[model samples]
Target: MGIQVWFIVLGVGAMTLIVWDGKRRRLKQRALSAAGISHNAHAAGSAPIPDLPFEAMLPPEADTPTATLPVNIECISGGSRIGSATHILGKVIADEPVLIKGRLEGTLIAPNHPVSVTASGHVASYIEGSCVDIDGYMVGTLKANTKATLLSRARLQGVVEAPRLECKAGAWLQIDVAQAASRQSVAMVS
Candidate 1:
């Protein structure tokens, strides 16, 4: 056979394979749907609550005056505090609102909750959460899946990923806000 004939045959074979694959995928999807398998199946059931990490579940009293912030000096706050003039570096996971009145330099991860930083807060780490109320200065990636609120006195410079953003009078931001509400909606449904 000539080269052209061979090429035509190969092309036909590839098209056939693609069509077969698509049909197979459709069949699988139908079968799963029939079985009631869905992405949001867990939302309504009272199934055993998945043991989420402490960082994902914010305590109500975390914002109260009597609340004592953890002094791990390793995760959230490191060892830096107000007037320390030191750099806090590492991964920070807080299940409660954390007030930082000092310097920080690392990645902060808080999911399914909101974390607030006071006006004295100066974080140089990536911040991630469902909602983050910032009233200080930050210079890193900031991802608030639901909402990111920047207080009037807040100053931030990082990539933000959220559907809704609230920048008060003097708040600052320097990045795009990626829409993460779909993910949150899925979580809520499941």
Candidate 2:
């Protein structure tokens, strides 16, 4: 039988021929593990990252590092969120630490700070920050000024630009490394 015949016999959802044997059950687990979304855990509750104003997430410019404005930046805890069905639309900027466990669709700018996307978090936006840690489903651009780390259960898809990108053993990254060659000395231009 041809491929079309098999599809008709089974279903369109069964794209891969697993042979229904014990040898291929592990492949299904690998696919689930990479996305960072656990199929066995579900207890609805509050949101992960609260809905804040666009200006609230912005970092105050200062003459030197370790200095910030008098803006009251709230810190969110991971335990408070339980993968709630909340969706945010717009740009989110933060100067303090951020932990996302819900769905966000927009640009998230948190420079000079740490941004953590948990396994339950699903971000469909551009994320720019100092140190980015992903352990969930992310489908967008990730630009890290310092470093970007993908945990063992992270699943990212899109262009990722950074000086350093580290992926764990079980992390899944569908990306290609790109090096910047625009850093030239002043004397070279002269």
Candidate 3:
């Protein structure tokens, strides 16, 4: 009976030691993580992340595409001044506002400018800008400075990459909304 009791006590003590060791290891890991110390020094030097603007995080290269310039359409003949009958059918590049009262069917690029597609506009191309306001219909990708906004009547079909987004009622966005909204909110403030 004495030997059996001793063996049980030893077993319990071993379990306690194991539990204590596990706790100690976890604490050590926490301390290391808090200090920003990586387990392997070599891995940190291989991949260097860039601090890119909110819109240019993807497509890898930070430079704008030099192969083609964006098309710019100021107005369409016979189209309503407020955008009654216009159709944009090619790439657009500009440093000014593009008020559309017609249709756009190409890519729109504004590296350092903002683009606003009014409620009467219908866009079917990718949009890259410092700021994008969509109150119309967009069927392509949208990348804006920290945020992309969809007014009440705005409709989107393709991917949206913005650190922030604002989607009012009746706005139709197919991708993630929460993250986009957060990004946009941050962009607006900063």
Give the alpha-carbon lDDT of every model.
0.56, 0.59, 0.56
Candidate 1 clash total? 1
lDDT string for model 1 (78-158, tens) is 322234354454556766545466665556677766666666677654677787777777665567878887775566654
- Over the stretch 92-187, how does candidate 2's per-residue lDDT look in tens digits? 778676777787666678888877787677776477889888877776567788999877556665556678877765556554444364321111
- The parts of candidate 3 lying over 4 Å away from their true place are 1-82, 176-190
Please name the candidate that would achieve the greatest TM-score relative to the true structure.
Answer: 2
Off by over 4 Å in 1: 1-86, 180-190
Clashing residue pair totals per candidate (backbone < 3 A) = 1, 2, 14
The model with the greatest lDDT is 2
Compared with the true structure, what per-residue lDDT tens digits does model 3 show for residues 20-63?
99999788557645645322211111222122221332223325
Alpha carbon deviation, residue 52, candidate 3 (Å): 34
- TM-scores for candidates 1 onward, in order: 0.48, 0.52, 0.48
Candidate that beats the other on lDDT, 1 or 2, i.e. the better one:
2
Ranking by lDDT: 2, 3, 1
Better of 2 and 3 by TM-score: 2
